[model samples]
Target: MNDEVTRYIDGAAPWQTAVCEKLRLMVHETVPEVEEQLQYGKPHFLQNGDHAAVIAVARNKVSFMVFNATEIPVVKGFVRALGKGDRKCVDIAEGQEVDYAALADILRKTTIAP
Candidate 1:
C-alpha cells in the first residue's frame, strides 16, 4: 500500500473503521492477486487492470462500492440484508456485525470476473 492508501484507511471516520477493515481483509484474503491502492480518495481493490471495489467512510454508514454492481447480482440481496442499498452498498452501523462470509464471496466474484 502507498502513503495515500495508508492515509485513506488511517483517516477513516470512527464508524467506517470496522467495516473498512473487514472489507479490506476480505479482499486481501480472497483476491491476493488484486492490488490494494487508493483512488478517488478511497481504499480500492484492483484486478484485471481495473478497480474491483472501493471502501469508504460515510456519514451514516460504512460502504463498499462494487465497481460493477450489475455483474454481481448476489450482492443486491446481500446489501439489502445489511440495511443498505442493494446492488450498491453493504452498509453497517458502528459496532454492528457483518456477514463476513457473504462479503468474502462477493469480493471473490468481483475480482474473478471480467
Candidate 2:
C-alpha cells in the first residue's frame, strides 16, 4: 500500500473514507500482487504495471472502477461505463450497501493474467 494513497483516503469525509478503505482492501485481497499508488489525486491499483482498478472520492459519492472491464458483467450499483466501455464504475453514496464480494470478484477477474 502506498502512503500517499492512505493519506488520500484519510483526507476524505467519513463515509467516503470508509468506502475508499473497503475498496482498497478489496483490491489488495483480490489481487495479491497488485501495486498501489496515488495517481491523479486518487488511489490506483496496478497489476503488472497496468491499471487494474481505482478508488476516487467526490463530495457526495465514492467511485470504484475496474479497468479492462469489457468482460465484466453489469452488477448492482454500477453507475457508469467508461473508457469506451472498457472500464466499469460503481458509485456509492453515504448510506449505500455495496456488495463488496461481487466487486472483489470483478477485480479478480479483470486483473488476473490471461
lDDT of each residue in 1-114, candidate 2, tens digit only? 799999999999998988888888888888889999989988899999999988989889998888998987665546478878899998889998989998887787787754
Top candidate when judged by TM-score against the true structure: 2
> What would the TM-score be for candidate 2 when compared with the true structure?
0.93
lDDT of 1 by residue, 23-64 (tens): 887887777777887777778778877877778787777777
List TM-scores for all candidates, in order: 0.76, 0.93
Off by over 4 Å in 1: 74-87
- What are the Cα lDDT values of the candidates? 0.69, 0.86
Return the number of clashes found in candidate 1.
0
Q: Top lDDT: which candidate number?
A: 2
